[model samples]
Target chain A: MTDRNPMKDQVAIVGLGSTGFSREGGASSLSMALAAATEAITDAGLTAADIDGIVATNEPGASGPEAIAAGLGITEATHHTKPTPVAVFSLLDAARAVFTGAADHVLVVTPVVMGPWNSRRAAADPWRRGARSGILPVPEDATMAAAYAAWASRYIHEFGATKDPFARVAINSRTNAAANPLAAVDTPLSFGAYEAARMIREPLNIYDMDLPVDGADAFVLTSAERARSLPHTPVLIHAATSGIVGKNDEDQLDGLHRTGQHVVVDQLRRTSDIWIDDIDLFYPYEGFTIITLTWFENCGFCPPGEAERFLREHWNDDAQRIEIHGRIPVNTHGGSLSEGATRGTGHLREAVHQLRGTAGARQVDGARAALVTPGGFFFNPQGAVLRTAT
Target chain B: MNGNSEETDEETDDVLIARFAGNGITRDSADHFRGRLDRRLLMARCADCGRWQHPPRPMCPACWSWNMTMDEVSGRGTIHLLMVLHQGPPATGVDYSTGHPVVTVELEEQRALRFTSTVSDDFPAEDLAIGTAVEVEWIERDGTPMPVFRKAAS
Candidate 1:
């Protein structure tokens, strides 16, 4: 069977906007989505009526594309999508809609409410029950952090890596976030403080976890040709791909460092002639510190088991001077760790900003292209290469 | 370790018992391979591909064969991974606020059958390490039997 040519440099992200990251209570999911979506459309110099496609990240009963469309007073959407689980998937959908001539001016939105919940409180929410019963078969006795902790344990065992590298990741993320005015947690992370942090799980402390924050992030995608006619410089969608390993439904009990992850990285690289060195910035999802570590290895940033060493030799060398500002910066917007986790949509928005040179304080110097990978437990991993329109 | 199933309908004050939400549910296709802590036999192997799997599913992941069989595995393995959670949602009435170590074991019979269970309070926390050998035992929490692990004698 002939492989389909990569959908490289076809679509461009014309506008990127967010309601800024917060620790909840500012607004509801629909309101945040509306604000972000509206910002994106207006930033693209297009009215809501100009958007004909909508792709909303699906959170059951959570307001989706239809609500955002109506909230924006968009009269109609010719190609509306059901709520998707992953932001990258929604992005791919938006890009495809523009690529396939399905629609122009596609809007993608994901909003999340990041607040604490308890078992008793969960019992009161009908939507919570549906999530527990139908979609995720998580054991009741299992703690929320069990899965990542397990993967980390195995990673430590197999690689002989210590918690120091993971600590560094948290430190770097916070250091970057400190420069970000909209970051949820902007406090500078020191190694001493990170080490002193109480361990929530062995080998994982509070520093290793990503804080849940309330906010929404949205983007506007159109044909590269169309993007040229718009207001802002277009961040061309150079390449993109998404898939799962073994089976999509298999419980990932084996571990997080899957063979399939390498496949994704390779396929994304093949989408364009761009090598890893050509990319100016990197944004691997930081849901957990170990996630970034594994991505570093699997995404071919460094050889296997060399991520920690690479960090030691390169990242930690100039912590105060070059930590946030680096040769190839990772998570310039602080990522989910310090930047608010808008269910990971924040990473995409940050990538677009970095590419456009619009990321003010945390901007990477002369960033022309970026590699963004979004992944988590049970997610069909997805990735994209975004480059500035030359 | 073997014991009768602690199947009950009455609400118990056991926090871990309260956490056991999949109490009544059972998969129909793989009834032979039971995960109940009380079961002497656990895990299923594909009769066609000889692949061993746990939390029993219908087909073999390796060979995708419907031919499968069940048998008891040696209730011993090394801790493949572990997490000691200090702060977590409180179990119904039990005070786990101090936290507990959750472990995943790579079974000696088949590494694919990784079983996750909490270590007993008596298990040495300071000694826990990856690759440390452990043995399974059935214990009752508020009269509800569940599987737990203890460090194996060297």
Candidate 2:
């Protein structure tokens, strides 16, 4: 076992906690991050002092590692920052922290404002202040919509997929979100709701977008041996990998199909002992419906362009439609679409819930194995395979 | 901010700072020649390499020579790709969409030339194909003639 995968039987997340995901919530990054850290420490039956290591993710204008470390009163471990503000990057940061022997237990967290994206856009778009990039960015709102429009058009022109099939994803996510407390847009989404929307870019309508919200979320990851003594069941981070694929590896946002998550997941499935089909559920970090579809296809869960067809065939009203890939639940905590945006951190918490069986109303029965694929725009992807370590 | 931008009284189109791809330029100046269409020419001549460069740069990439001058070359290039955007408001106004033709015109002198202009609003999508011969048509916008593309007769 020692000679085998070092990460194996090494570290697992035993505790987790988060703060309210709000868009207009006035808490600064430090305030919300601290709030999340405090909750996780208490939940883990420890104190801020117990955490000698801190893994902090830097948001656009938020706290960097030094600030997050000082704020948490933690003096140790590695500090990492991603291009995006998503928490999924922080999850990997914690995994690295525990593996490196730099810290005993690591807490990963990120706090961000969410709400009508138009509002967040005003705050997030740095160029609005005349900080010129020389090259104009295709509008943020219009970018995904345009890509999807082009993709959907190509899919229609090539694979024979139509708008009706694509509508099922929005409906299903909403259906699942209705039960999730963290969900932001859990309303009655109908074909009418999807069709009546104006085209922001081609093919993608308003219904296909995600609501921005404000919030911070954190998860406590510790050694698997220590997790055995914890109060709650532990979900061991079996295999963790982050993938950066697409055009211009450093620049990101080049190729959507070959994202880091897809590459890592493919390697995991091929080399690891478990097949993707064996996984009990998936926590796909979704910012929109198209990203979800693309992940499903790119992960080899389904063939390219067949995501919509798979949903229609499998997601019957009587059946548990949320089990996205071959009956495995995807984003049971309502995903980014339903759950208030945690910038990828929310998905991490959802993975823990399913593993601990503490998911309550949204629990997946007999969920012993779970995978969290967290990502957003530009196809920057990271995935962690977690198992309930007895 | 004006209607048709092409019909505007501005002598030439504003130096369209257009898309900020953010990659720094790598060439130098050669000559500051004006367009044959008339008015305000901007070119670059590498201070070292004796080569004519447009879309002015501070140095010549090929010879690593700073001996470059800024000059205007005939804004003529062949169309690499052209698309008809039936949707979205015109770049210059709110109600009327540019029906503008955004062409990736490969410059006759340099490696690239791509600018936004309204060759036709109603050009069907099928009519536009790869390798269409096109030349620059400066539609006056603001104060400069905005670089646009027109069908170069085969």
The TM-score values for the models, in the order shown, are: 0.87, 0.73
Candidate 2 at residue A305, lDDT?
Answer: 78
- What is candidate 2's lDDT per residue for B1-154, written digit by digit as tens? 2122245333333222221111121211111212323543355545455565434555565687655555555666654433333354324432324332344455576553332233533334565544556665555543444455567655
Query: In model 2, where do residues sit more than 4 Å from their true spots?
Result: A1-5, A75-84, A114-117, A120-156, A249-261, A318-320, A324-326, A376-379, B1-91, B94-120, B125-154
Give the CAPRI class of candidate 2: incorrect
Recovered native contacts, candidate 2: 0.00
Evaluate model 2: give its TM-score. Answer: 0.73
lDDT of 2 by residue, A1-390 (tens): 334456764788877877756445545667777888788878887776667666666554456666766887775554344435565567766777788776787777676653223354534545323222222222211232234443344345455567765566666667777777766666757778777866554455556656666567777888877778777887877776666643321221323445565676765664345556778887766565666776677777679778777767667665335555456766766667666556667777887888888888888788888777776434456777778875
i-RMS for every candidate (Å) is 4.0, 8.0
Model 1 lDDT tens row, A212-292? 666778899999998889988899988777756653322324555564566678777666666567888888877778877
